[model samples]
Each structure stands twice: as structure tokens, then as C-alpha cells.
Target: MDERIRHLGFGHPWLRGGPGAGDGGETSRLPWLSSLLLAVLVLVGTGFAAEGQPDREPLDVFARLLLLAGPALLLLRYRRPVVCVLGVALSVLVYLGAGYPYGPVLITVAVAVFAAIVSGHRRAAWWAIGLLWAGHLLVVHLLYRHLPPSGDAAASWWPEVGVAAWVAAVLVGSELVGMRRERWAHDRRERAAAETRRADEERLRIARELHDVLAHSLSVIHVQAGVGLALLDSDPEQARTALTTVKAASKEALGEVRQVLDTLRTSGAAPRAPAPGLDRLPELAEQAAGAGLAVELAYDGERVPLAPGADLAAFRIVQEALTNVVRHSGSRTARVRVGYGTDRLTLRIDDTGPATGDEAGGSGNGLAGMRERAAALGGAIEAGPRPDGGFRVRASLPLTPKETP
Candidate 1:
């Protein structure tokens, strides 16, 4: 219900005072305080104006009541701006018809008009102010002699021109204020949306980083563990080597996991170590060998410095592709090719053979993570079975610097 009212630009319908009482995103207690002040100003100002205009009817109980009526109606301007403006305008018209002295009394109607327009009720404000102006003209020009203070003559057209100008000024000023408020609201919404988008992108990046780190390390540990258990009884020495490889892989995995966690704990802090890049390819090949998979590394172009983002993406793509080969392929050999270009870097990993092993089935998140990394760096990844037999993954990453999302 509250959201519905806010969306309608009326604020809370039941709130008549305090913050958020007014409509169209007003959240101050100014309206409440201003209402009280306006009532007093109108009463006192009109009494003084009456002293100067001896030809007008003297101040009476009904005249004072009419002056206060407009300000009283202003209390509901925020929650019901259109209704408040109409009531205030009517009070102003009746006060004029009664031949009461005009002074700060018009101030009440101006305030109502401003509120109505700012609250997104522009048409209602126009009608109320327009009717008030027409009614004032009618009383002063045609009905003056019949209405109040005896011997009153009809008002001149020149004064009516000034009244029309005042009305136009009020309408223009109200429109300006409303437009400014809407612009401010639009900027705030845009900033909030940008913040939300950045947060989502950060979460996705972290998830992909964690997946690449754990998947490759765990695959190596799994193969070494299996070897250790199989040879434990007959060949203790070989089993010890396998155990050593498992321990090393697990320790490296934990280190990478801790590095990723450090980023979450320290906002905007420099990383304890630089992110892994293509420089780590040899280390990856060693790890794959420990998992009973031999990886052959080849280069196709002259080595050139890569942007940090592109380098990191290239390394991860190769890592994920090799990890997939280790888990899913029957062949024990995989080949990795790195091609450096003028504006982009290409990486291709191929394994020769058919599928095998219990680890052949996977959640498929590895390929997805690789694709996301390449895409983030304005690149693309293609993974499918090579027409010959084994599977292949080819990735092309731009060399351009990637802005932080």
C-alpha cells in the first residue's frame, strides 16, 4: 500500500505531518512548520492591510477565518496536493469576494500551487489557480458594489493585468521546481542501478576464479591419490612419490583459494601476489604431468607483452581446457598452442583420443567459466570434438586493457 501511494506521487495518504507527509519524494518536516507560520502571517498581514485600505470592509471574525482557511488546507498539500490547492484557492476567492484587504493572503494560494505541481498534479493546480484568478476578476470588476464595503467602485483593468502576471509567474516557478526534482530523482536511480550491476559482475568474476583454481588442482590430487592407494602394498617407494604430488597439489590449491579470499577481506588493497598469467604455463604443464597427462607447449608467434587481463584469461582458458582433458579424455597426451598477434592472443588445447574414466561426467561449469573469462576480456572460446577423435578448445582474447567492471 505504501509503495502504491509513493508510485502515484501522493506519498502516504494517512500521514498529514512530519517527514514523507508530502508527495513526489518530499521527505522533510518543512511543510508542517510552514503551514503554522503561513496561518499567522496571513492573519497579521491582512489586519495591517485593512488599516491602509479604509475603503474596504473592516476586519471581522468571518474575514479572519477566511484568511486562516487557506493555510489550514496547506497541511494536506503533500498527501493530497490537488484537493488542498482547490480548497485553498476557494478560500482565497471567498476572502476577495468579501471585500477583505489583500496582503500576505495570496501567499497561501501560491504555496498550494507549488505543492500541487511538485507532487505531479499540474493540471489540478492550474485549474485551481486559474479559477481563483477569474473569480477575483469577477468580484472586483462586476460585483464590487453589491458585495462588501459600501460606496465601492469597480476595479480598473490595469490592476487585473498585474494579477494575471503574478499568476503566470507562480505557474512558471512551480514548473521549474518540479522539473529540477524529477532530474535529481532520475540521477539517484541511475547511480543505484550502476552499483547493483557492478556488484553482480564482481560476484561472477570471483566464482569463475575459484572454479578454475580448484578444478585443476583437485583433478591432479584425485589422480595422484588413486595411484598412491593402488601401489601402497607392493611398491611403497612409488606410492610415497604419488603421496608427495597429492600433498603439493592440495597445498597449491589452498594457497590460491586463500589469495582469492584475501581480495574479499581487503577492499581496494593491492593483492599479496600478482595474478597468474601466461608466465605460469610451465607450472601448469608440470601439474598436468603429475595427473598422468603430458602436455606439450608450442608457440606460433613472436612473444609480446600482454595486458594483464588478457594474459590472465589466456592462462585460465588453457588451465581449464587441460583440466577437462585430464578428467574426460582416455589419451594421456595433450598439446597447447599459444599464438600472439598484433591486437589479440590465441590459445588452443587439443587432446588425441576418445572419452574414458569415471571422471568423464562433469557439471560443465569449467567450459562456462572459460567462456565467461574470455568474454570479459572481449574474447571468444570455442570447445568441441576435433573432427579426428579427441576434443579441442580454442580461445581468442583481445590484447586491449580491460576496465574493471
Candidate 2:
């Protein structure tokens, strides 16, 4: 049965019987049970009222049956509230015209009105209420027109007052429930949007990390491979050394790539190798030298410890800067200077002007990635053609730890 319902596109969890079946079943059953119970009460109350008024005409079989069916019709209220309201109202009018004693059929009408309001049919609810009131007034006028004026006018008016109060309560209660449901739905939508934004930010962070890790290593490999090919026959020893450099750089790049993949496979739970930092700048410069660029590292002031993120960002900045020197500057020599200050660390990389006029103006992802790394740490970077006819990349990053407390 559950499979069939699902196949028919009625497969809401609330409809499928399983772990939460009890709750769903109870919810589905409660309204029907309550409507049935109200119908029984209406039947018993009307019987007592008819018994109390000995002078009232006994209802014919058809009228009595219709009065009893009024509340039963309320079972449809949840699915077809408007129809139920109209059906019950019409039944009440027929029963009353048959000279039967009034019963508690109005309870079902109240339930129908509440159902319609909560179902987002406020306009229809109002129409139903108006029609019911008009019918009630018509019945009252027709039934009491030929009767003599009674002394206790308040007693006769009490039923009308009670009916108005019941209707008002139903409408107000339904509106409150509708408002609560709307608020719940809005909260769910907000939570979903927040999760999507978080996922997007995480993806962008990984992409940036991969770009930084692979770009510099690949650039070195490209240079070394070219050198190996050029000297393969003439200077086999030098060519083998170049090939060795290529192998080592490729191996290190693969390890870093594997670490990144492991982090992703484990959903970032795996232990990661230590990230490269300023301390690795010497090795990075050596790799640049092997790639045919003579690189020098210079430091000013005493060495200061940096926050881990800041250290990594500084290293990447230098790595990318050296890469640009090798690929774009066409410079044979480059200088990297690190300065430790009172509250921050600054790095500068400058390359001798291009070897020839043709290689002066090509820029790519290296500079942009370097800039992003610096800016992410509340730092700034400047990269452009230098006044002395070379290219310079300068970055200043704060030494402040991310978690001070």
C-alpha cells in the first residue's frame, strides 16, 4: 500500500508508514476522531433538547437522518472545507424547515470555517461565514415570525450570541496557526540558503589552495624539462641533473596534491602535512635557481614568529613572485627581501628587467593568486612595473594570530 501511494506521487514521509508512522498516523486520525466525537455529542444534545420540549414536533425519519449526517459530513473538512461547510449549512436549513428541534450541527460548520482559513482560503472562509450567517438569520425569522413575543428576550438571544462567539474563536485560532506555520517555513528557507553559501565558500577556498600548490611547481618543472632536452646529448651530466630537479619537483607537487585530495576524501578530517612557510623560502629559491633564475634571499631586522596562516601566505607570495620572474620577467637574476617589523612582516621580490624587449608585459594567475593570499590575511600586496625597468611584488602581512583568545 505504501509503495502504491509513493508510485502515485503521494509519497510524503507523513503518509508513509515507518519509524515516524505513529506520529503521522495520529495526526491523520485526530481530526476524523474529533469530528466523529463532536457528531456524537451533537446527536446526544439534540435528543435531550427534543425530549425537554414536549410540545416540539417530532422530526420525520428523513429530517432526523439529515441532522445526524450533518457532523459526519465534517470528515471532509480537511480536504474540502468549503464543500463541507455548504453541505452542513444546507442540511441544517432543511432539518429546521421540517420543524425538527435545532441541534449542535453548527459545531461542524465552525470546524469547516477553521479548516478553510488555515488552508489559505481566507476569502472563501469569509464567504462561507457570510452565507452561514445569512442562512441562520433567515431560519430564525421564518421560524419565529408567527410566534407571540416572549417575556425573556435575552434567553432567546443567547443562542445567537453563542454562535457568533464560536465562529470568532475558530477564525482567530486558525489565523494564529497559519501565521506560526508561515514562520516555520521562512526559517527553513533561511537555513537552506545559509548552508548553500557555506558550501560555495568552501569550494572557492579549495580551488585557491590547489592553484597555489600546483602553479609554482609546474612552472619549475616546465623550465627544468626544457633545460634537460637542450643538453641531453651535449652535456648529459647537466641534463641528468636537470632531469633530477624535474623529478623532485614533480614528486613534491604530487605529495601536496595527494594531501589535498586526502583532506577532501576525509571531509577535512585527515591529518595534513605541515604547510610550507617563510622557513621554506631557501628551498624555494634553490628550485628557482635550478629553473635557470639566480635568486637571492635577504632579510632585515631580527626574525619574528608569524601566525601559521600568515606564514603560509607569505611563502606563497614569494613562490608566485619567483614563478613570475622565471616565466614573465625574462630576468636572469631576482632578489627576495624579508623584513620583520614591530607588528608585521613584509616581503618584496624584484627581478632584473627582461632579457629582451619582447618578454615585458605578460601577466597571469600568479599575481592574482598572490594578491588574494595577502588580502585574505588582512594584508595588502603591490605588484607592477618598477621605476628602474624591472617588475616588483611587495606584500605586507600582519603577524597577529587568528585566534587571540
Candidate 3:
């Protein structure tokens, strides 16, 4: 029921205000006021027309007032369109049967029909029109058979023709108005739904970005902090170096986090720094070594440039793979191999075996995050214990040719 009122442009503003409500509320009221004014004008015109025709008898004051009442009642069209239309139809019948001047009394019927259709009461509107037309035919038949005729009966049909045309015009106009209102409402709903979907997607993207950034950086910081504490008594100098690495890692993490926050604060209006890509793999290997892992990087085939999405995914996958190696693998050595091909880029990170301690149970989002990134770019990832007795992560990212400037 509420939706119907909204589509008809008559919903209460304070109860359900939103875009277009002001205009819609005003528009919905126009039909009611116009119907009332039209009815009043028709009542006044009937008096004038009756006075001008000396052959016609003036209607009693009570009958004229009743004719006026029909249109005034149209003020309730918005609240109860079907009832108002039916009431107006009955009043018009009474006025005609009482031999009142048939001036603009028909205008009241037309307005009632229009109100019913505009208010989304099509069946009621049609029924009211049918009743009016049948009554009109009956009145014409009575006039032709009982009244003394001065001219041909064919000429008397003109009034009925005019009334039929007026009713048809009202029906078409009301239907057009209703259709336009429905279309506008549909468009507004679609735009709102689209905006909601965009917001959801953006939130997911930001979540993935924060998860990847914090997880990798925090893992490195955790390992270096452990090293610093373990060597504090045995090798004071090495302990200081470990502490220094921790400070540097923390600073870098802070800077990256600030960048992300700035982007969010500005609503992405500010330009961002270049994203990390495959070129940063060597630097990543160095950082892993500083965290106590023995790291080696190798490449096979000719290196080719990759699109921005594929490049970022490849970099993140490798970063996550190496972080896992440093934290979970017990062995000291790990190998990273990049195999470039004509259609795709392949990355492999393998560690010797499982490590001791609680590192394995650390936040388990790393592998899942890597897989999400790879799948987002139409790539694939595989990570598990290798048959050679160590953990391995392999990712394949398909390449797209760079667009020419």
C-alpha cells in the first residue's frame, strides 16, 4: 500500500521524505485542487448559461447548489479517488434528472475520471466513465422521444460526441501521467541500488589492501623483534643491529599505513605513490634475509613488462609467500624462482621444512589473501607442503598486453 502511494506521488513527505519528494507531493495535490476549482467554475457557468437561454427554466437554488457540490467533493480525490468519483457521478445524475441547465456539469465527470486514473484506480475510473456515458445516452434518448424537436435528431448527438471526446482525452492524459511517474520511480530505485553495490565493492577492496599490508609488515617486525631480544645478552652489537632492523621495518610499515590512511581521508582524490611490483622482489629478498632467512632469487626466460593489475598481484603473492617462509619454515634457506613465459608469469617460493614454535599458528589469512589476489586477476595459486619435505607456494598470473599510448 505504501509503495502504491509513493508511485502515485501522494506519500506523506515527513513520513518518507527523500529525493524528489517535494516536487512529487506538490504535484499530487495539484490534481485535487484543480478538480475542485474546475467543478466550481462549471457550477458558476451553469448559472450563466441558464440565465442567457430564455427558453430554459432557471433551476431551483437547491438544485444549483447540489450541482456545485459535485465538483467541491473532488477535493478528496487523493484520499479516496474511487469513492469521490462514484459520488460525483451520482450527484451529476441527480442534477440532470431534476432538469438543471446542462452547462459545464459534464466537466465535473471528466475531472472525476481523470482523478481516478491518476490515482492508480483504473478500474474505478473506467467504471465511472461507463456509468456517465450510459446516463448521457439515456438522457439523450428521453429528450428525443419526449421533447418537441425543432431540428434533425442527428444534430442532437453532437453533445454526446463532445462528451465522449472529452472523456477519452482525460483517460489518455491521466494514463500518460501515471506512466511517467512510474518510470521516474523505477529509475531512482535503480540508481540507488547501483550506488549501494559500488560502496560494498570499495569496502571489500580496502579490506583486502589493509589485510595484505599489515600482515606482511607485522610478520617481519615480529621476527626481527624476536632476534633482537634473543641476542641482547650474547652479542650486544648484533642485538643493536637487530633492534635497528626492527625500527626500520616499523618506520616503513608506518609510512605505508599513513599512505593508505591519507588515501582514505581524501576519498581517493589525491594521487597515490606507485604500487609495489615484481621489480621489488630483490628488495623483498634482502628484507627476508635480514629477518634470519637465507634467501635466493632466480629468474628463467626473458623478463617482460606486465599490466598494472597482474604486476601488483604477482608482487603481493611473492611477498606473502616469503613472509610465510620466514615465519613458518624451520629451515634457514628459501628459494624464489620467477619463470617468465609468452602468456603468463609464474612464481615459486619453497622452504626446506616446518619450523619450531608458534609462528605456524599466526594469523592464518596470508594464504587466503594470496589466493584472493590471484583469482581477482584471473590467475591461480597453489600452496602446501611440497613432496621434497618443505612448504611451497606457486602462483600463475596471466598477462595482458599493455595498451599503446
lDDT (CA) per prediction: 0.85, 0.73, 0.74
- What value does the lDDT take at residue 129 in candidate 1? 88
Model 3 shows how many backbone clashes? Answer: 2
Better of 1 and 2 by TM-score: 1
- Please provide, for model 1 over 6-86, each residue's C-alpha lDDT reduced to its tens digit, 9 standing for 90 to 100: 674434432333332344455343366889999989988888888899888788899888988998888888766766888
Once model 3 is optimally superposed onto the true structure by TM-score, how far is the C-alpha of residue 152 displaced, in angstroms? 17
Clash totals for all models, in order? 1, 0, 2
What is the Cα-based TM-score of model 3? 0.72
lDDT of 3 by residue, 285-378 (tens): 7777778887889999888888877887788888888878777778888999999988888999998886555544457888888888888888
TM-scores of all models? 0.86, 0.68, 0.72
Error of 3 at 117 (Å): 5.3
Among all candidates shown, the one with the greatest TM-score: 1
Best by lDDT: 1
Clashing pairs in 2: none
Question: Candidate 2 lDDT (Cα, whole model)?
Answer: 0.73
Lowest lDDT 10-mer window, candidate 2? 14-23
